[model samples]
Target chain A: DAGVTQSPTHLIKTRGQQVTLRCSPKSGHDTVSWYQQALGQGPQFIFQYYEEEERQRGNFPDRFSGHQFPNYSSELNVNALLLGDSALYLCASSLGKIVGGELFFGEGSRLTVL
Target chain B: AQKVTQAQTEISVVEKEDVTLDCVYETRDTTYYLFWYKQPPSGELVFLIRRNSFDEQNEISGRYSWNFQKSTSSFNFTITASQVVDSAVYFCALSMKTSYDKVIFGPGTSLSVIP
Candidate 1:
C-alpha cells in the first residue's frame, strides 16, 4: 500500500504571504496530523483532523489552519508567514482517533519563508 | 500539559561502539503512550517503537532496545553495535490515551557513528 504522501517537496514564500501544503494519508487511514520541524529541532504538533473535522490543535496561532477532506487528504495553510515559519512540514496518519496506533509519516514539505 | 526532554543534543561514536539516548517526559495523564522516531538525513520521521504507560517491560528489536522506567519517567533507547546508517536525529515523543490528544516531541538527539 502507498504510504502517506505530501506535495511540493520544497517551496519558497515571502513574508506576509500565504501558502498551502497538501498531504494524502496512507491507504486505509482516516486521521491526519500536521507537524512543524525547525532546523536542528524536533517535530512540533500543529493540529489533527478526523472525520473531516479538526479534532485537536497544538499551541500554534490562528494563522496556522488546516482542513481534511472526505478522502482523508489534508491541507495545511499558513497565513501571514513570518521568517520563523520556515521549516519542514510533516504529515502523519493513523488508523483512528486514539493515540496508541502507529503513526505513518510523509517525507515532509520544506517551506522557506524569505 | 505533556512534554518530553531528550537531554543529549548530539553524540558521536566509532562504528563499533554502542550508544544510549536518554529521554525524560512529563505528563499529567495516568494513561499515555511513549514513542521513538528516527529522522535520517533523508528527512523522514521513521517510527521506531511505541510503549504504553502500563506496559513498562523493556523491548528489544534487532540491534535496538528501549528501556522504559515509569518510576523515573524516562524512556531511553540504546543501539548495540552501531553502524554508520544508525546516524540520525532520534526523537522521543509522548501522547495521551485520550481521543484526539496530540503527540508532544522532544528536542531530539543527533547520533553520529563514524567509521
Candidate 2:
C-alpha cells in the first residue's frame, strides 16, 4: 500500500500568493498531521486533524490552516504566503491519535516562495 | 514548555563503525513520550523508535539500540556495524499528555556513513 501520497512534489509561489498542498493518508488511517521543515532543520509540527476537526495544533499562525475530508484525504492551505514559508511541507498519517501511535510521513511537497 | 534537543549538528563515521546520536529533552509533564525519526535524502521522515516517560528500560532492535534515562531526561540511540544506508538526518521529538498538544522536534543531527 502507498504509505502516504502528496501532490505537487514542488511548488513556486510569490509572496502574498496562496498555495494548497494535498495529501492522501495511508489506507485505514484516520488521523493526519502536517509539518514544515526548513533547510537542514528538523520538521516543526503544524497541526493535526481527526474526524474532520482539528484535534491539536502547533504554534503556527492562522495563515497556515488545513482540512481533513470525510474520506480522510487532507489539504494544507497557506494564504498570503511569505518567503519564510519556503520549505518542505510534510503530511503524515497514523492508525490512531499521534499520542499513542506511530506517524508515517510522505515525501513532502517542497514550497519555494519568491 | 516542552523541548527536544539534538546537540550534534553533524557526525561522520566509516562503514562498519559504531555511532551514537544524542537526544536531550525537557518537559514538566509527569508522563510524556519521546521519539526518534530518520529523514533520508528522499525527504521522507521515517520513525526510528519511540520511548515513553514511564519506560526507562533501553531497547535493542537488531543492530540499533536506544537508551532512555529518566534521571537526566535523555534518550540516546546507538547504531552498531553501521552501513552506508544508515546515513540520514536524525530528529528527536517529545509529545506531552496534554489534551491538545503536538510533538515538538529538535534541530536534528546529520549522520554520514562513508565506506
Candidate 3:
C-alpha cells in the first residue's frame, strides 16, 4: 500500500543543464500530475498525463516536459534550467479521470538550479 | 479561468485554541470541486477533504470542520483544540469538471500552533 513516491529526492543543476525527476503513482492509480512549489508558495500545476498522453497542461513554459510510462510511472524533465526553476517538484496521482477524487502526493523532488 | 485564494498568509495560535483558515475560489464552470491539503515541514501535501459544487453541507471530521458556501464561493477550514502538531501550511484548491481535472492551488496559509 505504498503511496506516491518520487526521486531523486534532491538534486542540483547549473544553468543550461537539464534534470529529470521520476515518480511512481500510488498503487492502482492510473493518472499522474506534476506540480512545482516555490518557497513560500503553494504547488503550481505543471501538467497531467493519462493513458500515456498529456491530458492537460498548465502555464509552464516549453522548457518543462514530462512522460508517463505504461506502468503509470512519470518523469518530469526540465531543460536549460534557471535559478527560478529551483523549487520543489511534486507528483500527484488520482484514481479516476476527474479530480473529484483525492489526489495523493509524493514527498517531492527538490531541484536546485544554480 | 480558475483560481484559489487563501487570504490569510499566516496564523499563529496557542495549543488548545481554535483557528479558522479562509479560502476563496473563482471558476467559470457550473460544477466544480474544492479541496484542502496540509503540508508540514516535511514538504509533502497531505489531503484533508474534498467538496463538490453541488454539496454545500459543512463537513466535520474529528476536530476539523469545513464550511462550503456557494453564494460566497468560499470553503473555510476550522481546527478546534489545536495542538503543536497542527503547525503546517494549509492550501485550498479548485478543480472544475470541464477543465480536465487540473487542480489549481491557493497561495496557502501557514499555521503555527505554539505549545
lDDT for A16 in candidate 2 is 100
- iRMSD (1 decimal) for each model: 1.5, 1.8, 1.2
Q: What ranking of all candidate models by TM-score puts the best one first?
A: 3, 1, 2
The candidate, 1 or 3, that scores higher on lDDT is: 3
Query: What lDDT score goes with residue B80 in model 2?
Result: 100
Rank list by DockQ: 3, 1, 2
Q: How many clashes show up per model? A: 0, 0, 0
Worst 10 residues of 3 chain B by lDDT: B95-104
Clashing pairs in 2: none
All candidates: TM-score: 0.97, 0.97, 0.98
Clashing residue pairs, backbone N/CA/C < 3 A, model 1: none
Question: Clash number for model 3?
Answer: 0
Q: Which is the leading candidate under lDDT?
A: 3
The segments of candidate 1 whose C-alpha lies over 4 angstroms from its true place after superposition are none
Residue B100: error of model 3 in Å? 4.1
Show the lowest summed lDDT stretch of 10 residues, model 2 chain B: B95-104
lDDT of 1 by residue, A1-114 (tens): 999999999999999999999999999999999999999999989999999999889989999999999999999999999999999999999987455877899999999999
Write model 1 residue lDDT over B1-115, tens digit each, in one string.
Answer: 6789999999999998989999999988899999999999878899999999999999999999999999999999999999999999999999887643588889999999999
How do the candidates score on chain B by TM-score? 0.96, 0.96, 0.98
